[model samples]
Target: MARGCDGSEAGARLRGIYRTKQSPIFLPDFLRSRIHVSVCALICVVGGWPSGTEERVIQPVSNEEIISLALDEIDGERRAEVAGRIAASPDASRTLAAVTIAVQTMRADDSISPPGEVVQRVLGLMRSGVRVRTSLMDVAGQVAEQVREFLCTLVRDTQSEPALAGFRGTTESRHLSFECEIAEIDVQVSRGEGEARRTIRGQVASLTDDTVGRIAWRSTLTGAAEREIAADESGVFVLECPVGVYELSARVGGSVVRIPPISVA
Candidate 1:
């Protein structure tokens, strides 16, 4: 006598039952009853057949959720489920990819240094009421002046240095200093090879004691060439542009400090 069928045999038997149900051939009443009982038992063993209402409902993922997923805020089983949903949705997948790229770019930008201690001290002084007493009209006038564009007078240059032995060998770098009532800017331009771009390094410092802590500045190059860069905490910045005549501007606080057109060769 053979033992009962195993899982594979049971599956085969189930398939046979299905085929039997579809067949028009006549079958004994006893055999039909046994097939029906077996199928019912199999259904119970498998936790019952799935009903029409038991289908999985896919909910659309929102952009915020997708951003959180890209940031790795979602983890474990939920991460897997969200990833599956995103894979199934073209729009969601594109959004996830774009958000991931932007997150990476922001992480890269985090390497920039934060505001220096001088800025902190300035804030402390303002909080302590150590600033000058100014009338509201005076304050308004100052703000208006700051918003206007003003030229910075060139105070010094490398050419001002006395020639050594009446002859100075050619150099590739030029140093310049410009000053205004608000701040002073020092710049160094390094000349590159023929037709190559020039590297400009500069620093901005406050001219008045009250403005010493306002170190946040932005440098911009415009005209025959164009580039812009934010100064670090120490009011230092570097920029590069092709050989051309450009007007350099440093926006310190609300003031726009404009320098004369600089020709680089």
Candidate 2:
């Protein structure tokens, strides 16, 4: 058996049903239908309808939301709803256009991957619990620092013989030397017999008795720095490379010293 509704109680129940129907809250179809019946009964008893129809206001979508929608993150029904709003409102369309243009402009800027050695160093630091800045501006700063650290300033360069006079023979070799804070670099460049590429031999030495353990060469033209040659106990190393500009790097003691760029041609 169900309890019957008294006059005041019935009025209060009718008001609640009408409020549920007009509220923004979502309801299932069966519950909505039951509420509709109560609203109609109340309307008949009161002999009038509600003052006015409730209006549904659309909230403005944020820029972040627009970007998410462009990225296809908002899917299915929500995607349709957002797309419809964007298409209907000129302001929303303009906002989406601005965001698209900004993203395209950023991608159009020149970008290059850092060298493999730099990447390894950064990864090692992170593994050792060193904190690295992750902002866009910080990326440029970090890359600049990496490049600066690898590039040693040229203190002096000495050429053995003059090219114009040709004092030696056609197979003459030239010697060039450079001095940095960590080490002094001596390099010899000469053409190989019957070979197309040239031969480069170098030595890295420090005044304070720090032995150079490793020497690596990077070709500016090919952007390759794969092979790392080991130096002798006296810090002497040799390499056969193509005719191009190269950047030589050596690891001495606890510091890495980078010699200035050299050209074989």
Candidate 3:
């Protein structure tokens, strides 16, 4: 081994010591618990935990490799090695590092346990929230609203497509259009047939809304199970119940419309 001025150790002894040492010089105390990175993020307490808030810097690893490794599915020594690498240097400055870790954790596992202290705290927030760099509260709110709009488009597309397979297949497209159906609000059921029918037909004039026909159905598009919902005058709107099984009473314009369950099955 070529010796450096810093007194570099070489060969088998070095590899063995690095892998098996309980206290490698580079390993952060916070990561020594051998806790799963996910759990470590969640259960890591502030004061009692090995590292203090001031010592909690995960920095100076200019390469993204350490971040990738820290987030890998490995446990024990491998995970420790990755975190240690990230925390090794003092001058690293990737502003997104913390947020990146949090998002990666969630994207990696949905039910990831949070490490109770700082890292986990940020993880929990990012789970149900988005990270915004905006300093203005109004701008932050607007950004959130815009995000919601985009998200609703996705959710509605997902929910509506499967529910309306017979009606259309605009699920994957970014934009879709369909002629609206002018139907009345009503529900009908035939127990003899073990079937329930919900008719979005009737007085179309009195029950029309901007959403009428633009959206295919008024029920939640669930399985052919029992669902409850109110139909607008034009019987166009979002549904709280799934498909086919008509519900008992749906509130429309603050009024309840009761009908025997409808069965599409």
Candidate 4:
């Protein structure tokens, strides 16, 4: 039998095959150690793993965290880490961008002012650390006891203005303002999508305090069905009805404010 090749010669042959073929092959124990070292070196060079550097770990950021970041509530080294991770994640980056834009927009928008008494009450409660909770029925009873009816008087009407009478053409829109003891109502009547239909858009502002919440309102067109809608938090409401005279009413706070019949043509 021919003498077996020496370990050095066998190892060199195995390394040559590994380099040329770039595929797995059975190797002797000594050859395996040599090949492992060569493979590691090749990987460091080809896979862009710099020596003595640890790989970065990316963690997901939550929506609340992103919002806090936008609000500048986060600070120090943690903020930097979170920002880096957010930058690495496309979805998180987009969400953060959207939240930032929304915060900026809200900052630029108008804000409602609460009554001074309400603010003082809130501050007092905060200082005292007392929580005042009222039952729904109790609140309803209080509202009922304070409820009163008032007939709003027309304060201004562009249609009836003598100065505009000469200039008034066949306009499709009209503006009216009414006032009562508790609130003021500004209404815009416009032609609706359908023929012989009218759209009424109105805003109610409390004279005593800010309109705190949604208020129930109704419109009754003469000889037609009544339409009921709730005003938005800002006390804005819209109604569509056939072209006819309408009596509108809004239940604001403890008061029922009613407007006289107004013709919509």
lDDT (Cα atoms) of all candidates against the true structure = 0.58, 0.60, 0.32, 0.62
lDDT of 2 by residue, 51-137 (tens): 452222344455555787766688987688677757777987888888788877887979889999767644443222111111111
Q: How close is candidate 2 to the true structure, as a TM-score?
A: 0.40
lDDT of 4 at 135: 20
Question: Model 1 compared with the native: what TM-score?
Answer: 0.38
What lDDT score is found at residue 223 in candidate 1? 14
Candidates 2 and 4, the one with greater lDDT: 4
The parts of candidate 2 lying over 4 Å away from their true place are: 1-171, 193-195
- Poorest stretch of ten by lDDT in candidate 4: 128-137
* Residue 147 CA displacement from its true place in model 3, Å: 38
Clashes in candidate 4: how many?
A: 0
Tens-place lDDT per residue, model 4, 100-199, is 9999999998988998865664444332211111121133465654556666899999877754555557675789999988888888899897998888
Steric overlap count per candidate: 0, 0, 22, 0
lDDT of 1 by residue, 37-152 (tens): 67656655665543562222344566656887999998997788678878988999999999999989988885756468545533443322111112111333656534544467
Q: What is the TM-score of each candidate against the true structure?
A: 0.38, 0.40, 0.18, 0.41
Candidate 3, superposed: residue stretches over 4 Å from native = 1-60, 73-82, 88-265
Q: Which predicted model would earn the best lDDT?
A: 4
Clashing pairs in 2: none
For model 2 the local lDDT of residue 191 reads 84
lDDT of 2 at 65: 58
